[model samples]
Target: MDWMMLGIVLVLVFTVGFVFAPLGLGGGMLFVPILHYIAGWPISGELILTCLMLTGVVSWGSGLVHRREGLMDESIVKIALRGAIP
Candidate 1:
């Protein structure tokens, strides 16, 4: 990818993370559509994968910070994890 395109993508990703982190919103939904439709990026497997991974990483990072700050409920997290596991 060109430097400019890479820079734009990075900025957009950071912006999405910044806006959604505190709200505990998943940016994958918005990121894919914005990048593909608004930013004119091609809708492809690679793009989708990258968006998913980025969303996971950002969400995890935010969750970690909140957890460390004692904002998260361990019991709720345990229950959610149990339900999420098949």
Candidate 2:
């Protein structure tokens, strides 16, 4: 990647990591669509793979933080899954 592109990516990474992270919004929600709409990245299987890669890391880290804060609930999780799965 060129320097400009690299810099934009770093900015996006830190922007998502710093801003949305505190509110428990993972970076991918902001990153992926920006990549798609602004950066003109293709909406394809590759984007899905990229989203998984980035979001998985953010989500795992967020999970750890939430677990430490004792903010996770099993019953609520089950309830959400019950609705989401169908």
Candidate 3:
């Protein structure tokens, strides 16, 4: 399972997620450089996986925040999702 690789990835992802979550900054910017240079993960698959992971975590975190604030508008989110759907 490449636990070392996965552990490093999870740590980096979650740390970046926690840090950037509040500032509304996404992890895509950091993920590529880190995966390519720091972790030395392959460019092709790493990019796709990192993006998917970031999207999921960031969206979930934001949704939780909005939910807590009572400002999570389902209609708007649904509309955005629909537009994004292929």
Candidate 4:
């Protein structure tokens, strides 16, 4: 993998995170395409998996703050996690 392209993709993901996080979204929709098309990464499982992990991290960051502020409901979260995890 080209390190320079990877760095650019990371920066773009971080910047997109700011926009999407506010709306309670992960950057996967943008991330996968950015990595595949812009970064010239080939379409493969690893590319999609990378997008998944990156988006998961981005979403987790905002979720953490919301949880700390008690803006999240534990019961609903548990239900969602049950389905999501499986």
- Winning model by lDDT: 4
**Over 4 Å off in model 3, which ranges?**
1-11
- How much lDDT does each candidate structure score? 0.85, 0.76, 0.76, 0.87
TM-score for model 3? Answer: 0.69
Give the CA lDDT, 0 to 100, for residue 49 in model 3.
85
Q: Which model scores highest in TM-score?
A: 4
**lDDT for model 1, on a 0 to 1 scale?**
0.85
46 Cα displacement, candidate 4 (Å): 0.7
Ordered from best to worst TM-score, the candidate numbers read 4, 1, 3, 2
The lDDT of model 3 is 0.76
Could you give me the TM-score of model 4 versus the true structure? Answer: 0.85
Instruction: Tell me model 4's lDDT, rounded to 2 decimals.
Output: 0.87
**Tens-digit lDDT track of model 4 for 1-86:** 57888788778888999889867888779988898888888999999899999888889998998999999999999989888985
Going through the candidates in the order shown, the clash numbers are 0, 0, 0, 0
lDDT (Cα, tens digit) per residue for candidate 1, span 44-84: 99889988888888899999999999999999999999987
Which residues of candidate 4, in runs, are more than 4 Å off? Answer: 1-6
* Candidate 4 clashing pairs, residues 3+ apart or interchain: none
